[model samples]
Target chain A: MATSSLLLLLADGRFPAGAHAHSGGLEAAVAAGRVTDLVTLEAFLAGRLATAGLVGAAFAAAAHRAVTSAGSAVRGSTLALLDAELDARTAAPALRTVSRRQGRALLRAGRAIWPEASFDDLPSTPGGAHQPLVLGLLCAAAGLSRAETAAVAAHGTVTGAASAAVRLLGLDPYQVQALLVGLASRCDGTAAEAARAADEPPERLPAAAAPLADIHAEAHATWEVRLFAS
Target chain B: MRAYARLVARADGRGGTVLAELRGETPLLLRQTPGSGRAVTVYVVGGAAGPLAGDDLRLEIDVGPGAAVRVHTVAASVALPGRPDVVSRMAVRAVVHDGGALHWLPEQLVAAAGCAHLAESRVELAAGARLTWRDEVICGRYGEAPGGAVVHTRVDYDGRPLLRQSLAVGPGAPGWAGPAVLGGAPATGSLLVVDPSIPHETAAVEGTLARLPLAGGPATLWTATAADAHTLRDHLDVEVEPLLTKVE
Candidate 1:
């Protein structure tokens, strides 16, 4: 029953964090004809999870650990370094913005339930309370391990894609939930890998690979018909 | 020579690559400077902008938590009129800490005749942070006889590969005048914006101005993989709007 509650908490799409408004780049993919069905969508989702999603998870884990170990007052440069790196890799204008929006929403939600993120308590000058930063802060408060923090990051990412799928393919919500459940292990594995490497110095970062995705994102920006915002 | 970026929370340059930390509360302090050193040396600074001479151009930025720093160029970058020397590569990098947002928006790049330039930009996102921006690379003289030009650009984001663009335009290059990368065209430009908050209808978000006018140009947009992440790609086939034509 406890596990079911956690699953429900992670699975509920209507939790009001604004996950319904974004298709990430799937909507643009659909308009551009790059994604037409579930198979391609799955491939795309898997590919992203392995790349951007993996990176996000790793950073979230590191950040969660940073908050707990480095004390509550962390340096701003640490987060900015991650943000810049994320920006450098995000080729699509839509996805970059989408991630921040979701990140922000997550932060907002975190404050109410998990006060460690302390959204209402942060210094107002630092408007850059990005989603991952908030996630890390909240995870610390939740008493979650480093691996669990990474999993949360991965879960949020899948949720973004699954939400987009419902609108793009009109797939049944139950099916999406089931697919998510089945794929949980894969996401967890990714989280574990991310947590394992969370302690690496920022200088020795890995290389990102997503060309078709970037070209599509740029082209999509020039489009005249898109269903989702990003 | 390849330029290596050193990570520093704060760098102050009185006139060049140096900068002073912001003494106030906000972490971000952005300043713009015109062309310097007859070359381009652009970097992020804390609070002020500098000038560009025949040698260098610099930017210093210090982004504090929740603070936003923006460094914009007053005009498009012009690679000196006449040049014949080793590759004049422009390298730019940034160190965005937690709770800090940096927007690097430089004007369009204008590569005139006889210009050999290699531009490189690298960024790393720590975690739970955000970055929104665009970059446009232009080749050839905007308003003069097209000249032989060469551009080799490599852009990377995060730990993955983002963009690897190699373009060579000369009289003898293969398919120089064919319907390929540039569609047998003389002058071409590319724009990339990595922001997710654009609009729900991202495909429809493109405006008429986003297109280039040409009698028979190919214009299209799609999502492809780059640096292990999905990227949106757009192609404007040398076709400028009929009403607004490119004069050379």
Candidate 2:
């Protein structure tokens, strides 16, 4: 499927979509001396996956499920609900803005290349939809398999953390990659968990624990010398 | 610095609602000893409980799941003396069930001249449960220019925190030092809530916050949602207005 290749492309950290600019609050963690080394980074990433990542996975899966309902008039309503729901769930103003920013970035790129009717009608309202949901639908439209969609998400989260840490803490690329390899199983396990529970209701979907990340994100939003975009 | 304290109340959970109802219900008996003391403690030996006083007070809240409790204080906290490292501390422990609402709002604290106060509150939420908490701190006890007081609050929900808000008046803080950020404003307070349904992708939610009418005062909201926690921070800079009117 096209998604397999697309997944490979998106998984690369070199993608010039500006995704490298955000540490997703990890910058604040580093600034506050909360995430100083690789072990702390691992803990932070794990927490995010359970909390924020879980939410992203659910929305992505939901969006992917709805991608095929093109003629179904409920598409608009479903999308609207997903957008609003995600918006409400994201309490940090900075985080919400970042989500929409990344979503727009993905939408811009996906629309220019894919040019599919599905991508054409993507919402434009401020804080419309998260990038993950957008990318999930885009991947689905590109004929990606379920495994590929899950892999893209897992890769993005890990890479986003690693790249942000590299810029924030200036770590050795080899060390970070080793850390990523070590955490690869956790990401895979999380992704597999998401895939298996895809049938569960959205409200009942599991959320991994990660409150410190939220705290840091709020603190980061008010920082004076912020390095990372998020 | 001695924080004046007074509270005599029915420690009974009698009031159905503190905001809407509680008309005919016996007013929570609250009496206190005033002196602006630091180690002020009012044991819940009597009726309803009230908040600790003083501009420099430390409030610690810890709640275990399924604990039904509510707390409030009588007179508005006063910062009579602001120097000599005067402070107050209030630590809360609560573990509310799936259907408990702890409406904790003691009177706001007034920061007198050069008041550096730190207030921290923490709450942990369980699945299918709700926690409604609203509290405000107004700085500038003497109506100085740019309003006064530097208030800092850190509230957490579960292990995943919901709120971490810090406010500084004219100086000593980051935003007030420059022309941007707060725009050299004064007076700020916030109302924050955290519910289930944490966002997966992003952690900041300003959609519901931006819609708030901050009146004509200097105020801003800070919020974030990740995992099981949600946090909203609101601040107000009071001018020549009554301290009680700006809050509540």
Candidate 3:
């Protein structure tokens, strides 16, 4: 498959990566009334993009670099280091579980689709490998560039929450798409930044965080009934 | 101006801890406050005014095996504005040996308007070490707008990464106060506890507060935002006070 077409496929929301089940913390924000309409939703997505989006994209790009640049002998250890560093960046246990759950799902998909890829290099943690690390490996296997991997990661960070906003708030689909379109440049810029920073060591990668989102995620996990898993 | 301070606590073998070495410079004075029991308390008093822009400060804390030390500041350290293009910085490095404990509970750091301050802390914990680290930031004083301030913290447990985060607010940080970040609250603080004895469970959110367990180890992080510093402390204390008592 053409690399560009493959990028589009992996980034698609319809992909069976289990991303469709999580709201990226939008459900909690909506439940708290902190995100009531399109304006607040835009702010939420922008904030998420700047903090969580940036960090996740950076780690993904770094992981891509690890698998592609390192020899097979050291690839597993490098990937494990990246996973541990990303775990450090993610403070919320619920968010961690969600990321690993999604990672497990994505790994299953990657193993079936690209059976010959180096999927076995992923660290076998208690839950699973982090979603970003799995994404980086899969993107690398698909012949995608590091920048493209970061873009895919950054794109999912906002799009998942944006899609959830549509269902949770019942907002206009057109308006939501427009909001995403407005954020496209930012997503690209963040991806580029993340890709550039990927050259650094794992500990030096972006660690930007959204504290309120972490709080919201923990609360959302406890909800008896919710529209999304996180 | 530039200054560096160092403090070392060692187990006295008398069911208590004592300061093995205490040194301070002009703007970073160290004072031992009277306290009883196995833990030693130290107050960080400012000998001179301002960690103003253009000032550089460094602090080193080392806790010997089985030693317990609690460090607190006498008052909030204000990041005052100085010459343009110059930034003030405070870097703290700490190490806790096996079975040692350190409670770093400092006062709020006020980032005054037009000031550029960067505070960074790196903590290393050996096996069986316990830590209670607290940090609070007040964006601005009175009616002024906040300046640029970044609080970066990295904690390592048993030589592995546990928590690493950098929170940048005001000026250069565009969307810091947005709903997903601080939600426009000027007062933000977090308490990090690395105690293996605590049960592993998630805590509920109380208002703008939430306590989360770190994934890599037996650690919990409590974060909160409030309209003001006083309320921020109250919110943090609701969850942190109990944990501190357990440490004692």
Candidate 4:
């Protein structure tokens, strides 16, 4: 598979990874009246991109590096360390569950598509592997570079929430796509930075946090009827 | 200016806690309020003026096995502007040995306008150790825009990472007060409790507050944002009271 085409395929939203079920915290943000329209949605997405996007991308890139560079004997431990570190970075339990659920979903898809991939190396945590780690491992299996893995991770962070915003707020889809286009360069920049930082140790990776989002996610999990899982 | 303060709490063997070692510098003053209880209470009194820019201050705390220590501050520490291009830093490093407990409940930190400040706290816990760590930040003084401020916190339990997060706000940090971050709230804080005795559960979000149990261990983190410090503290106290009482 050509690396560029493979990157596009994995980055596509229809890749059957279970990401569509989660809103990335947009449902709660909308309920709080913090995100009512496209203008506020743009601000929300930007903030999410700068913090969560950057952190997720960095971890995904780092995971990719671990799978590509580490020896087979040490790969499991390295991936476990990455998973634990990422868990530490995620303060909210609901968000953690969502990430792992997505990871489990992605793993199921990866196993069927690339049966020979190193999916066995994923840490067998109670919930499952973290989504970013799974993405990194799958990207590596598809012969994608660290930078491309970061880009996929970064893109998902915003697109998931943006798509949710359209559903939750009934905003114009064209405007939302335009908003995403405006953010394309920033998405690329964040991915590049995340890829560069992937060389650092897992403990030293980006741990940027959004306190409001953490609070929102916890609350969202409690609602009786919510549009998104997280 | 640079200052490093230290405090050590030890079990007295008579079912009480005592300060085994106490040392303070110019601004990071350590004072023990007289009390006869299982937990030795210490108040961090400000002995000097400001932790102005270019100042580096550190506080070290050690809780010996079976000892309990509670730390408090006399008043809020205001990070004032000082020399240009220099950043003010306050670091707190703590360790709790086996069967020990540490309650770090300091006053809010005011990030005064025009100041560049960095506050960091790292706590390590041995097996069976418990901790209640709280950190609050007031963005700026009244009628003033906040300067650059960053708070980094990391907690390790039994030699493994439990929570590691850094929140940056005010100047130089874009979109910090946006919908995804603080969401225009001026006051923000977090309460973390690491006690194995407490049942594992996640609390529902109440207004601007929410509690989440960490996935790796028996720990819960409650985060809140409000229009003012008093309200933020109240929101945190509501969630913290039940757990603390149950643990005690």
Candidate 4 residue lDDT tens string, B92-151:
999999989998888898989998999988899997899999999999988678888889
Lowest lDDT 10-residue stretch of candidate 3 chain A: A220-229
> Which regions of candidate 2 fall more than 4 Å away from where they truly are?
A1-3, A69-71, A206-209, B1-248
Pairs of residues at least 3 apart in sequence or in different chains that clash in candidate 3 = none
Per-residue lDDT of model 2, residues A1-230, tens digit only: 65556677866766556788888667876776667787677666655654566567666666666666445576666665556545545545566678888888877777777775486445566655678678777777777755566667766776797778887888888898898787788777767766555556443344322324444556667668877878
User: Pairing residues by index, what is the TM-score of model 3?
Assistant: 0.96
What is candidate 1's CA lDDT for residue A126? 32
For candidate 2, give the docking quality class from DockQ: incorrect
Please give, for residues A1-230, the per-residue lDDT of candidate 1 as tens digits: 55545544643566656767766456655665555666556555665566556767877776676666764455354555555545444534554555577777876777677654544433232334445656666666666777877887777776787778877878887877777776778788888888887788543343233333444445565558777655
lDDT of 1 by residue, B15-113 (tens): 222223422211122333444321112333322211111222222234433443445555655454333444445555555555444555455455555
lDDT of each: 0.47, 0.49, 0.90, 0.90
TM-score of each: 0.48, 0.53, 0.96, 0.95
What is the alpha-carbon interface RMSD for each candidate? 12.4, 13.3, 1.2, 1.1
Give per-residue CA lDDT, model 3, range B29-130, as digits (tens): 999998977789999998877788899999999999989999999999898888789999999999999889999999999988998999999999997899
Q: What is the DockQ of candidate 2?
A: 0.04
The best candidate by DockQ is 4
Candidate 2 overall Cα lDDT vs. reference?
0.49
Alpha-carbon error at B165 in model 3, in Å? 1.5
Q: What digit string (tens of lDDT, one per residue) describes model 2 on residues B17-41? A: 2211111111223322332211112
**What 10-residue stretch in candidate 4 chain A is worst by lDDT?**
A219-228
